[model samples]
Target: MSDQPPYTWWPAGLRRAGAALGVLGVQWYNAARTNIGATATSTVFEPFVTTALAGAAYARPFVRFAGTGTWTLGRAHFAVGDRSAELLAGASPPGEGTYGYTVTRYTNEAHKGNGLYRDLTLELVEVTNAAG
Candidate 1:
């Protein structure tokens, strides 16, 4: 009963808000990911490592393969400044075992930098539980 386009049927404010939220989330992910996505590019490949700890003391370590000798995170480790490579406890709801994940490395030649954000599919992979 409306002549307006299907896409325009939604409220303008709602659409804008959704897009804004999406962008904000991206920025946050990049910030957190910077911790590991820093050495994305260099003559010698630098292995980016990330350890997951519930608290502070003893904890399990999770290693990630950043890039190869030819392709590194040197200039492409900026796209995920705030993105978090590890999944929070809340996100997993407490678990253990080997998990699978897909790490997405972001790159930007214009900014002269690059970034990466990993997305875990299998979820939690608890190797050893430390009573710390």
Candidate 2:
């Protein structure tokens, strides 16, 4: 009844490989803090997770192949900040604690062959919010 061809499980091997790689990838989260309630005496800040962008948000996983230095992969060259998140190194995600970071700078190196994926490098400084 449909004009499109029916889908089949072609190239099952490739699919399985991709799924396995996905399991090894790290998780990234867009960090945000919002003032839920504010009065003359006090203000309450709450952690906010969103995909929406106010300016720029670092919230995606990428394969890290090098340490905290400039390196070239294929045709991409980039550096990892010293304060980069451990999650980038395949560490487990944060626990119940909420952390805040200041984005000093962010750079993206576009791969020539694949325009869909870009190598992102971020320089972050950890900050604490006493008001939170």
lDDT of 2 by residue, 22-64 (tens): 1212233334523222111111011112122332223332342
Candidate 1: minimum summed lDDT over ten consecutive residues — where? 20-29
lDDT of each: 0.23, 0.32
Tens-digit lDDT string for candidate 1 (54-87): 2222111122333322222221121111222322
Q: Supply the TM-score for candidate 1.
A: 0.14
Q: Write down the RMSD of all candidates, one decimal each.
A: 20.4, 22.1
TM-score of each: 0.14, 0.28
- Point out where model 2 deviates above 4 Å: 1-96, 112-116, 130-132
- Clash pairs (backbone) in predicted model 2: none
